[model samples]
Target chain A: MREARDAMTKYGRKAHAITALVREAEVHRDVYVDPEIFELEMEHLFPNSWVYVGHASQLSKPGDFITANIGRQPVLASRHTDGSIHVFYNRCPHKGVKIASEPCGNTGKFFRCPYHAWSFKTDGSLLAIPLKKGYEGTGFGDTQANGGLSKVKNVVIYRDFIFARLNDNGVSFEDYFGESLSTIDNMADRSPEGKLAVMATPIRYMHTCNWKMLVENQTDTCHPMVAHESSAGTAVKVWKREQGDSTETPMAVQLYGPFMSPYEFYEQSGIRIWPNGHGHTGVANSIHSNYSDVTGYLDQMVAAYGETRAHEILGEVRHNTVYFPNIMVKGAVQILRNFIPIAVDKTLVESWVYRLVGAPDKLYERALMYNRFINAPTSIVGHDDMEMYERAQEGLKSNGNQWVNLRRLYESNEEQDVTAVINGTSERQMRNQFHAWAKFMTMDMDKHAEAAE
Target chain B: MITEKTITDLIYREADLLDTMQWQAWLDLFHPEARYWMPLEWQQQDPVLQPSLMYEDLLLLKVRVERLTGERTFSQKPKSRCHHLLQAPQIVACDTAAGVFKARTSYIYTETRGDMLERYSGWASHDFVEVGDALKIKLKRVDLVNFDAPFGNIQLFM
Candidate 1:
């Protein structure tokens, strides 16, 4: 371990660790099982990156707030009187007590700290202090930083998808995300009004596994055929039995049965890996290719966007897009999921369904069905993935195999870069992620050291 | 007067069938067109418009049964054992002319699988209709106290 530490440089130390663990085709089990590494991830990757906070639509009006977390820090997001969004630490500046207790609520005008009676504006600017002149000349309220509820270093709202970074030393969210930001735009553009909003409260479930497992599973096409064999296969069998010799199945069956698509189909789906560790697979022509059309919806879209533009908008379908560290989006169904790592082995997955504003009732209904049928805690498909994730976490703690293989389909004919298109079945996405993980962990060490110095 | 005692007896009888895993007997309690619903929201009023944890017609119910009892249902491989403890039911409403009756009851549904046990306690309301000779369930709604809370995999009916 000391010898590995001796190879340390501001940038090159990560390279040594990267080479030792993540390779072109395989990764070591220590990444998942080690407590020290998890701490490093929380410190480096989560707060430092452009982490997703919540959507602007969720904080509808001034004073509407939603409390969320970035890494281990409790963060609060709200809309101020100026109609701008603010993401700040949820703690009171006085004694560091939590300001809001609920998941979401409207703070109306200002937030009054329940503990010390200190008040702050919706944007977290300190409003008024209780007992005004207690410390007349003691540098009280002398500096803005010392007075206000501290703002997160950066908050970016790209077409309603809100993101914040605890560390200010990163690129713009657009520059950081690159082409992957289009998934958000495409989701919003699907509606006739060219906007999207979250409908209903999100359905959250817990996975007894490390958080990374859930993130990687988003674009993993290999497991659906096997892991989801029971639920997907059951849907197909039951639909067939009910239909006898008929060629058509119910929409529910159609939605689920596609998980059992032939390996050849997935191979043809194609995968897109962004240089920034973001990736997604082709999905416009999926099992939902022939999903029943909602009456009057297309015409409404055409009326709003014209024929050509509407058809182009309607034609685009990208399945699940992993927005790097946080957020997984299923474009067709409008289900977005992100995981909160509660502990070393526990993760809470929050799944939010979206409503394309001005879209027909049927469209939102489909999203609701997709969310209820798959993302809900009672979902059979989610159970299968959860079971595998928990089992993997358990197995990694064993002495049987020190290496978890990502070697499948890694022998590439495709050109490799930070951003590259590959076969859907290839493990390139997972490899791409670890490549970023190594970089984030190693690079942030220099920052932490500088902070210490 | 059909009597509250009879209603309580019927509710307990239905529960007994569920605890004992008598799927067929439980099915027999419901009318052919009955709906069994568990709304995702706390006081969800409309299943069609709102999301629901479960909204099953007879066909869907049969499919759930098939999956739970079938040979290859991976999650239910070892099967789930449930014990239902019901308090005496109270009649909420009765319309003899329309042959419709509604009763409210509370129960604790304990499900054991492998080495884990989960208890779901909730108020339930059964809307019944007099079908020919006996009572048949028109609607069965489980207002789970934890409906607003997240849950693990729920393999058995509440």
Candidate 2:
């Protein structure tokens, strides 16, 4: 188990030993702290899996582009003149400078490298070169092989949510996401027009911990009552003091009340885990279940999808659907959070709120309020969680414990199944995420195509 | 007439309340329908449609104050502390008929907890209403210079 970790061991063999860090119900601290393991994850895990890049709405107009990262590699997505979206390495082929320096903007007719001004079409094909006559005899050419932005291997737009995979070595998009794509679909279906538009900018928060901690915390339903007691618990006390006699719960209380919900509330909500590190923690109920109705929003949804379908869509309440390795979405609330790992101990979390097109503006306001209340840098609830993550990062350095436990409800986990249904507080989702992590990090790239199937 | 000194004094008092962690006393400075806004974008127009970093009415502000003072709030165990260094405030507008006045102050704020400290420079724009010789905050908008940068936990009000 330890042989492959030897300093002199070959790179390929070293990854095989990484699986040793993860066990049935325990994960070694090195998995979260080791620089070498972090490098391996960037190389093997991020490139092979379909990581979300941007929403199609962001690139609705031709020549519009946005810059993002796949692991450590900087990439950009742009809508071409032909109306097709393309994801490419943001690097200019000449002298390797970034083509787009801004967070997002329209590239006009084409992207021009700030250094030396080598231009490329929105499709990432090299269009023009400065002083072309000088390069006639040289190896430089207009073709992509000579000078062009390299394209990512795969790009999938499922219900206007754009996802890109850096390498072509792993599972097909369909095989990887499977039924988990429904979360995106569910979000779009909430809009009366069956469309969702992302706010132009996302509110980004930095976490001084491994990115996986945020992903795991999404489905870890037990923490809210305990960890958020200060924020939510205080809200409960204040509500009882101010509005105890009132029959109608105010919107603020309705939003903050669920954080103090008993463990049984989550258990009854149910947790479902799907293949490839995808899962959500709600079926019958969630924190989103009790939100006050926005007047006429339901009627618009009913007009779009008939009464029964509308009710079905509205009734589908999910709290945080983790799309393996990077993205998490709250379908019921129309918010998406992407976790970008900055280093072994630092991660950037971006929260984006979406507008349900055709729904009442009041509903969108509620979503915006929720984002500010829970995810903002100044958020009362978010600060507590940030403290916990930072503490975990510091505590992992202690020699007293080499393993972090995930044994809650482990005895009943349906280990052999592709999908598992269990109580909301189960650690099965974390286990599922780690299993997928091991598969992506350790398995041979050649075998991934078949392994996913 | 609301003199510049009178408005500046009131603004300074507000900052003093915040710096001393007088959570309840600071809460009393705001009118019933006051809004505390920290816009996420440059020249952000619609707080309802666009997402702001901090947008809270009096109720939300009360919740924040309660949480900050809560016994179980682990994040505040170390007690994040902040200091406001403000440039001389300028009274931008005075509408005597409406009993409303606007003041803008450029400030450099620093927050520290344990070993970590963060410095933020911004303009705090305040809308004040005179009520019975007392000025109450109708709105306090903070516009940080790096409003778009990814930020760590802003544990307390800026």
Using TM-score, give the best candidate's number. 2
Evaluating just chain A, the predictions reach TM-scores of 0.92, 0.94
TM per candidate: 0.92, 0.95
* Model 1, residue pairs in steric clash: A275-A418
**DockQ metric for all predictions:** 0.55, 0.82
Best by lDDT: 2
lDDT of each residue in A314-389, candidate 1, tens digit only: 7877778888786798777788898887777878888888898988888887888778778877777887787788
DockQ of 1: 0.55
